[model samples]
Target: MIQEMAETLDDSGSAAPRLKQTKQNRQSQILAELNRSPSLRIADLAARLDVSTETIRRDLDELTEQGLLNRTYGGAVRPLSTEPSISERHHLLVAERERIGRAALPIIKGGRIIMIGSGSTTTHVARRIAVELRDITVITHSFGVATVLAMNPTIKVLMLPGEYHATEGANVGVHAVSFLAGFHADFAILGASGLTVDGPNEALIECGAVYSAMTMRAAETVIVADHSKFDRTFPSRYAGWQQVHHLVTDKAPSDALRAGLDANGVGLHLA
Candidate 1:
């Protein structure tokens, strides 16, 4: 009888720790999903995690108290001030970026020079270009983009000179912009932090200058951005809608943004 009582006590003690561990794991998962997607609805998260909406709400509450995320009306969003590093963004929205990359491929032609800007989405485009196209030259200030295209022996990569931004994994400075001015490209494939009615925006001023230079030197400008960027505005407006030739994205733009694109004659390619 004593043994049975002791065993029951032991089981109860272990159960508490196990429950705590499970909660911690669930919270970790919530953060990971938010990293992949900037915002998450409670119902969607609860459904995906196989938990009750109440439980998800509690987790969100704890995370918000810790300042990890901001709780919204019925969901949570990543902190707006915290921009994910390029490496982190590379893992986020993989499928959507891949679709955008592939859709932008038609803009590339053989024996032509293209300038690719730095961003997770642009890196995807570089990967597609390296595998599918040959006998072309790529001019880029992004170390990541240059590295991807270098794998294709037939494709020549020209690296621009500038100060390197470690987090962005790209070169940005007066030198990079000046170097771009010396040469023109058939297409400038770029990425933006946001895409609103005003235009494509960049978070970094130096990067914005590089993009602007590329657009000016290219025959046509292709902006590759995911749905997360739609209807959003950033600090620096790199180019006006009239300067952008094509926008390759995973979803349709908002009504106002679409009107702006139409007015400026920007081609919308939905991936």
Candidate 2:
């Protein structure tokens, strides 16, 4: 009787882990299916995973709470592509952004003016620049970028004049674009909401205009983005692939995006 009780306890302990793994695997399968298409129905997932509809619904609810996907009426869809506010995005993909930021440092030459656009990834680049580079002038409309660079006494921060966007913590308007046009820079380091085969894009048209001006005014344009931005397209196509000179990212572009970058002679640097 004692031996049988011990054996039963061991089996229960091991079965708990097996059940946990099964649930995790099921959720992963749900995400994978959603990635393949746009949305996933609970009935389809249940049939495919060989689980009950209730199990799929519970999994979807848990995934939604974790912000991995959005739960719909009878299914789930990929997280909305709409750009999140800077405050929200700044906390997402932090490690990847830091790596991408560090990778961008080599492209900057000392004693040259660089134009930076406003975004979470670009703010990471600014932080790296503050610590790594010196005696460089940074032209930007981003309050966050300027504040980061201000810590380094050697770097000069130029704040552009425009309408201040509180959520983005950046300035954007005709004034900012016109001010940027008046001066040229050695390099332009900008971030993107999404990057696709067509090119890098911004969520806001005002910010896109500022990025567009920076790309044209600089000799070489470097786009800093993470894997999350890959294969995603936004409303504003700030610069075409031909205008972008280098892409500093944590992951390599997809096949279609790579072909576009190659056709345009854009260099890719993976962190």
**Top-TM-score structure, candidate number:** 1
Tens digit per residue, CA lDDT, model 1, 67-185: 89877556777865666778888876799899999999986654399999999999999999999998998999999998888899999899999999998999999999999878989
In model 2, where is the ten-residue run with the lowest total lDDT? 1-10
Against the true structure, candidate 2 has what lDDT? 0.85
Write model 2 residue lDDT over 33-121, tens digit each, in one string. Answer: 87665556788898887789999999999998998886654677677564568887786668889999999998875438999999999
Which residue pairs come into collision in candidate 1?
none
How much is the lDDT of residue 97 in candidate 2? 92
TM-score of each: 0.78, 0.74
Q: Which candidate tops lDDT? A: 1
Off by over 4 Å in 1: 1-44, 48-77
What is the lDDT for 270 in model 1? 96
The lDDT of each candidate is 0.87, 0.85
